[model samples]
Target: MASLEQPILISFKLCPFVQRSVITLLHKKIDFTIEYINLRKKPDWFLEISPLGKVPLLRVKEHVLFESAVINEYLDETHGERMLPEDPLARAEHRAWIEFSTSLFNAQHQLTQARREETYYKIEEDLTKKLAPLERKIGDQGFFEGDSFSLVDSAFAPFLMRSQIVADNIGVDPVSDYKKISKWRKNLLSLPEVQKSVVKDFEDLYMEGIYERGGYLADQ
Candidate 1:
């Protein structure tokens, strides 16, 4: 916020991490610009500034910050009502689950990218185990922790969005059975922030990526 210029978020259209940051920015109603890039053919300027050479880089004037979680934290802390809890223990718990959501995203990626049914089902089982605790944590109010949207919700929105896309395109629903998670996902997906987080053609692009991967789900 020290800079007067609008923040620019470097992104890759298919990256869930980038989508999560976009969700946070939208939820906070932050004014920003997004620059799309090809990970396969990284621009020389992008590679030069990004230490990790990753998308979702937040450029604030001359300074650049990488990593989706860090960028969301910076945006939330500086721009609007804090999405994170004020209580130390509660905040830490949310942070832990946000980190856990990263693994869920990884497993979801593996689920979509698996070459065989066995691999896909195995990944689904692992995701079930990972999502069980979150189900208990979800309140009837619909958001991750409770009635209000938080950073935790932003972290997991991408995963839920992708899952819904897979269900629509491939007949696979990783979190279909959990009643609480199902409701939570429905509510999250309904939000304008979650809805507008990705590109307009996100569903087609995501389904196309699955088919291009030649994975078991893609065939289905």
Candidate 2:
């Protein structure tokens, strides 16, 4: 393994993608510093380096990296213990699910911003349909793949956390009916890495953002 200097992570307080990378870094027990930036008021230097102008830009020794998944894979490849599977087939499957997790994030965004009852239920229905396959695939083990935590768990943790937070705010239980998902969520939440991945005021900031946007959940 190469000896890597502690990397600097440029992050936004509320981004789930950034949270994924944070969780991976923490789980792997790699040394890194996080610099929080406002997405609305991105610095010129940030825009100059990041083609996408996104958060979770990583500054490795003399180089920069963008995209949460790419950064995470790079870290796993170069830094501490690997989170991905050694088997090529298994690794491919994990990567596929990681991509699927992004769709869940999209659903969460739609659900949060929905103001009308019809729109809310529509998105909720679609979300439920999406989760059915995961519910079937997840085993009785503690984490997503098995007893050990992997990148798939890190990838999906933010989505599950967001769902529970929205449910708490709206008095609706989105994942409660899915037994496997609920168990997996409980397991993920119990991990220190997942719990400490976000800022100290994460819940307050998340709720306030929804309320400020006049979301249906906030109204309820």
Candidate 3:
């Protein structure tokens, strides 16, 4: 494994995956630098190191790690107390849920890109179905597993945060039908790590991006 030396996180401003890693880093109180890159015009050096040409790449000395889940897991294992459960079975369950949350992000992405109201509704319905299990399982105390914040909460925070932003801008709430999910999302959004994960102008930039894409929601 590569050693950390003022480790760097390569980011694209609106990337939820990158924001996930940022939340982990912040929650751990690790000292690291973030280098924002323009995804439209990725630099040659970045292209050389990033296998998938994606954001949320971690630069630890000469070693580079791609994929947000891998980067976040690496950060969790390398610094501070582990966010995952110590029990193997429980930890695996958490990992699976984190993977599930990634799918929700994809659905949200589709929702934002749907150009027709019909298409948008279809994507939304899919997202809602995906949240059904979470609505049943989210602990009443807060966070994913309970009162303690873990990697699962961080994994899902970006999607909820963006959902709220979209709702605030367009009056469409994704979790409205699921009371537990809506409440869970509110608590997730209030965390300091989640709050500080995005750029200072995130809401403006996010809304502007949706308009630029000319999605159906943009018209609202």
Candidate 4:
């Protein structure tokens, strides 16, 4: 077993990217401390650790790291959890899917806010069109990588959960319509570690953004 010090994670309670780091640590059963931050108003210590000024920065002993995917890999490597496979081709494929999911999210889902039902539906339509390919890709595979959960699963889970919330808020069920993808999402969320790690306040985040977009903003 690789030795690990108690890592410190600088994160935001509502960021899906930061949530990915939390999930991986939980999956590996690694003990760590969490320092929640406000991205708009970052803390002095957080900025000192990550000058780039981003949340989800992981500090292991004297070393610091950034980016959600990179943080997950660092956690796996340091803790010897092997969340990612050693096979080069398999690892590449996993990375591909993770990047693909992030790209799709950027294209269609990132800007969703409560405007009109039609506005949310437009996002749903874009996501639905993009998801057809993923649904076919899974085609009943229990996980993204063959039969076992891997790094790709960790990277993808946060986005799927966020998407589910988006669908719920919009009153349109993307996962429900996409059979294979829906099953995959269910399996990912069902992991005990995933449940423990993913932030629970995502719906409120959505609601806050939506309300703000609607010209109604409070201390949320």
Candidate 5:
């Protein structure tokens, strides 16, 4: 077995950004220390380490890395496990999908933290529009690239998990409309490695804290 090093992940239990970092760590099977933080009142140590005072900062040895995407890339580069493809074009494609996934989440789900029905619909529309490309890209493939899980899958998993919450909350069946995406999501979820690394209840993670009086919106 390769010698393992301990990494400190500054994290929030429910933050998607933090979840991205966690998923990457899990995908790599890297052992890490979880330092849960409170966004309402961030720790002094966290601010010092992250500068941006964001959760999902990583401390490996004496080096510190911040921003979930940057931290994830750093982990891939430094860790023995290689989630990225060796081919240049494939690597670029992986990065492109990763960006697409994160952007979709920011556009679709982040604003709903206010838990407003109007906001939910707006996010849903954006998601519906975005799904076509992703569906086309992932159709009937074993993975996004057609054979193996890559950084693209790890990057998208967190948002897909959150999207299920949106679909459930709005009573919109994403799986029905976007069968390819649904299948892709199922494939990603079914990965034993992904299952092993997940640490939270995803349904609750998105829905529990969102609505004041929890239930689906009418006509949603």
Candidate 6:
């Protein structure tokens, strides 16, 4: 086994994308340091190094890497047990699903930020429409591809975590009707790596963000 290189992950406390990287690192059991920064007040050094001015930038030795997906693929390729499949076609399918997970994340953001019942329900309907395919695709196995967890699970876990938190806080479950998603969520939440992927005050911070946005759910 190649020795793992310790990396510093530059992150924001509540970023879901950053959470994905954190979960991947923790799942791989890699040694890493996390540095939180205010996105509103990014330092000159961070701005100089990050081309896209995004969180979840990985600094390994002297090399700085950006983009959560790219960083994750690099990490899986270089260290720990392989999270991606070995077959070329299977690997490509997993990559596509990983990309699809971003749409779920975006839909969740829209749903959370919606201030009106009409908008909220509309986004919810759209989200359900989006999830229908996934509900059909997901099988009896616990994780995305099967019994084993993969990069796809890491990519989608943050959205599931946040959705549950929002549902708990607002008393509305967006994913209640999706049986497969509900089951997959339970499985993901049971993992130690997924449970420990976020900051201690994650729920508090998430609710704070929702309240700050003045959404309908926040009022409820």
Q: Pick the candidate with the highest lDDT.
A: 3
Per-residue lDDT of candidate 5, residues 1-220 (tens digit):
1112688887787777777778788778788887776789976767766777667778877878888878888888988767888889978887888888877877654445435677766766776788788888884774776677777777777776666656667655555587777877778777775665456575665565666444234334
Each candidate: what lDDT? 0.89, 0.88, 0.90, 0.73, 0.71, 0.89
Query: Which ten contiguous residues of candidate 2 have the minimum total lDDT?
Result: 1-10
Q: Locate the minimum summed-lDDT window of 10 residues in model 3.
A: 1-10
Measured with C-alpha atoms, the lDDT of residue 101 in candidate 2 is: 91
Which scores higher on TM-score, 3 or 4?
Answer: 3
Error of 6 at 167 (Å): 1.7
> All candidates' TM-scores?
0.96, 0.95, 0.96, 0.83, 0.83, 0.95
Global fold similarity of model 6 (TM-score): 0.95
Candidate 4 per-residue lDDT over residues 140-199, each given as its tens digit: 775875787788788778777766765666554666787877878888878897788745
Worst 10 residues of 1 by lDDT: 1-10
Model 3 has an lDDT value of: 0.90
Predicted candidate 1 versus true structure: per-residue lDDT over 1-220, tens digit per residue: 2243799999999999999899999999999888898999999989998999888899998889999989999998998799999999999998999999999999988877899789878988999899888888878778887689999999999999998888877677868988988888999999999999989999999888888899887777
lDDT digits (tens) for residues 169-195 of candidate 3: 899886888887887888989989999
Q: In order, what is each prediction's RMSD in angstroms?
A: 2.2, 2.9, 2.2, 4.4, 3.9, 3.0
| Residue pairs in collision within model 5 | none
Clashing pairs in 3: none
Residue-level lDDT of model 2, residues 48-90, one tens digit each, is 9898989888998878899999999998898777789999999
For candidate 6, lDDT tens digit of each residue in 83-196? 999999999998998999999999889877898999988888888898888888776677886889899999999999998997888887767798889999989988999999
Q: Count of backbone clashes for each model? A: 0, 0, 0, 0, 0, 0
Report how far residue 28 has shifted in candidate 2, in Å: 0.8
Q: After superposition, how far is residue 90 of candidate 1 from its true place, in Å?
A: 0.7
Let me know the TM-score candidate 3 reaches against the reference structure: 0.96
What is the C-alpha local distance difference test score of candidate 6?
0.89
